[model samples]
Target: MGYSKDAEHVGALGAGQIAKACNNYLHWVHSASNVEALALAKRYGVDAEKMREVLLKSPGDNGTPRNFDRYRFTWHENDIDLVLDLAQDGDLILPMAALTDQLVKPITQGEVVRLLGEESCVYLGQTVAAREAGLDD
Candidate 1:
């Protein structure tokens, strides 16, 4: 076995959705190495540089202030505050529901796709639950 193809599955599990919805607020995550956006990516396991590129180029408010963009949040603060910032305050819906459910317990793979959206499922055509959502394309 070469171990070259070894890959760890992140299973979106609501975390990916959190990364998606909070793109706008990414500038404020406040990690030492990664400005803020990258920190959020690390929180949920995403390529910071890739995330910044995809999200920055996508739609939504560029300067919009969301949870991830807080100027006052300290290092000790929790992620729920950040999620809530983008979700409830920023009007970011998908990540909110996922984050909320995630708080009670870890989100399932199905829940990840449910919030992230099927279009995002570039790998396996989305989660099994996503199939129920129906794929017209």
Candidate 2:
């Protein structure tokens, strides 16, 4: 259960921060994609729980889906911003990171909890679709 073997010194200075930013960027992107997949399932009446179970056993599995309920939304925005800032400093173009930043900016802690909660099958996309369809909550 330990990842100590994965730890190593990459470079002289500031490399750790860059590595951390890259890790956070992947984490945020994966988390967002997990939610989107769940939302897609709900939309298609595919049984969210079953979809999640299958996803856990499939190649699509990641830490996000396995630990969905335990995820915290506090630092996602800041983390993505750090990534974008790093990309800007390097004069690199990262459209996906920019899109991820925008998509994650509007999410609230309560929304994530409610959407991904153990006893709940409702997702943000489901709610949005309902609203657009003129249905009542």
Candidate 2: 10-residue stretch with minimal lDDT:
128-137
C-alpha TM-scores of all predictions: 0.20, 0.76
Poorest 10 consecutive residues by lDDT, candidate 1: 121-130
Per-residue lDDT of candidate 1, residues 29-121 (tens digit): 212212333433433545434555565566632542222223333322245456565566667576534534333233223333322333222
Q: Give the winner by TM-score.
A: 2
- Regions of model 1 farther than 4 Å from truth: 1-34, 60-137
Best by lDDT: 2
* Count of clashing residue pairs in every prediction: 0, 0
